[model samples]
Target: SAAELLGDPAAYESMSQAANPYGDGRASHRIAEVLLHHFRGKPRPADWGGHA
Candidate 1:
């Protein structure tokens, strides 16, 4: 059963310390940036556009 599998202390500890094969928190930020870019386009502030 699922509960039995998770109930083992050794298994739980191993799972907790396991590294995420996909990504970490940075993936979440990247996803948000892509969504924002899709909806709002690139952000070019006025300060950055002024160049002589």
Candidate 2:
């Protein structure tokens, strides 16, 4: 895989620029949104962190 990526500059660039599927350092925001919605009856955020 490393050699294949090295041999293809476009592939390497695309992989390097791709968004991380794991997260974007906003786990706290998402968690807080869920907790507030559950406990305080606040409206859930549009993002909803991820899928149900």
Best by TM-score: 2
- List, residue by residue over 1-52, the lDDT tens digit for candidate 1: 4685578888777776788766564656666676677788965322322212
Clashes of 2: 0
Which runs in model 1 stand beyond 4 Å of their true positions? 30-52
Estimate the overall C-alpha local distance difference test score of candidate 1: 0.61
Compute each candidate's TM-score over C-alphas: 0.39, 0.48
Cα lDDT tens digits for candidate 2, 6-38:
999999999888788776778898889989999
How well does candidate 1 match the true structure in TM-score terms?
0.39
Worst 10 residues of 1 by lDDT: 43-52
- Candidate 2: what lDDT? 0.81
Instruction: Give stretches of model 2 more than 4 Å off.
Output: 1-16, 47-52
